[model samples]
Target: MDVIVSRSGGLAGLWVTWHVHVDEQPDRDDWYLLIRELPWEEPLPVPPEPDRYTYRIRCEPHEATLAERQLTGPWRTLVDRVQERSEPERGRPANGSDRTRPPSSRRPRRGC
Candidate 1:
């Protein structure tokens, strides 16, 4: 299962994104259950704030958004951890950075 989270807007108007591969994660079942438990079928509960952050979550056949104040328990937990993993830790790359991007192709240079 692939979970992609996009967090947009903040004090700085920055947008952050997260992509979590549930299968590769340690608590795959928990993640799956959490995702299923989220209220995806409902419409945006309230009108959005002009500059507040909103989240766009997409995974498999499920997709939804938690905008501004709508960031509740499970959704909050999910995004928090995803962001934590996104921050630079130690001298290495961000935790989930490796799985986020695909490999690029390289061609041989012409003979000089």
Candidate 2:
């Protein structure tokens, strides 16, 4: 399974994207559970704050979607964990490890 999270809609409207191949993730099953816990069938609600960042998470092969309002419970956990791990460290990979990722247009992960 693949897990991708993208954050868009801040004051500047720039998008930040992150993703992980769940099968290679350390806690793969846990991520699967979190994905299951999200309300995939529901359409994302209108953002309460137009400028407040909202996340678009696509797990299970890009089939599900959720809104900021629905980002409670496990949804919150999933987002938080993804955000935390996606932050790259100096000389560290974007996924926070030695494992290499496919090339993309995203800026190189910056070291703290």
Candidate 3:
């Protein structure tokens, strides 16, 4: 299974994404356990507060969006683990550069 987590709407208003392939993880079983315990069917919380981060999580067919204030317990655990173990999504580096791709392969700009 594949897991994706994205955080947006923080003070910087930047979108940061992380992705993990569960089958590639050494602790896949532990991830499965945490995933199974999430309240997927429960209603999502109210709209996020201004300038607060919002998280969107997806594990295959199951997905949820939660405000920063609502991330807790198992949800927090899963997100933290994924962020620690996974790579940044393509073209959405937390910094200004694309960490997934090599610097040599980047195209040069047409104009200065």
Candidate 4:
């Protein structure tokens, strides 16, 4: 299984992404359990608040888009775990350096 979590639309309007392949993780079962617990079938919240962050989660056949305020409990845990265990992508460094954009082909396009 593969999981990807992307956060965008904060004050700086930057896009940050994290990815994990369950087979590559030492704690694969734990990640699977967390993924199974999410309310995947539930409706996504309304559009995000102005200047607030939004999260887009994708786990194989399932995907969800969430407003920042909707991130909590299992959703929060899953996102945090993925970000913690995976390398930051799209020019965001692991050492907390300033985020830089990669080539245009790698840039995340706005909107669905």
What lDDT does each candidate get?
0.60, 0.58, 0.71, 0.72
Model 1 TM-score, all chains together = 0.67
What is the lDDT for 108 in model 1? 20
Residue-by-residue lDDT tens digits, candidate 2, 20-58? 666667887887777777766765654456756566666
Task: Give the clash total for candidate 4.
Answer: 0
State the lDDT of candidate 4 residue by residue for 1-109, as single tens digits.
Answer: 7787877666666677787777778988888788888998894665748778778888767888888889999999999998889877653333344332221223333
Each model's TM-score, in the order given?
Answer: 0.67, 0.64, 0.76, 0.77
lDDT of 1 by residue, 6-59 (tens): 765555444466666667678778877887787778737545576687677666
Best by TM-score: 4
> How far out, in Å, is residue 95 in model 1?
29
Could you arrange the candidates by TM-score from highest to lowest?
4, 3, 1, 2
**What is the alpha-carbon lDDT for the whole of candidate 1?**
0.60
lDDT, residue 85, candidate 1: 56
Q: Which residue pairs clash within candidate 2?
A: 90-111
Index of the highest-lDDT prediction: 4
Overlapping backbone residue pairs in candidate 3 total 0
- Give the higher-TM-score candidate: 3 or 4: 4
Clashes of each: 0, 1, 0, 0
Clashing pairs in 1: none
User: Where is the poorest 10-residue window by lDDT in model 4?
Assistant: 103-112
How well does candidate 3 score on lDDT at residue 57? 81
The TM-score between candidate 3 and the true structure equals 0.76
Whole-model lDDT, candidate 3? 0.71
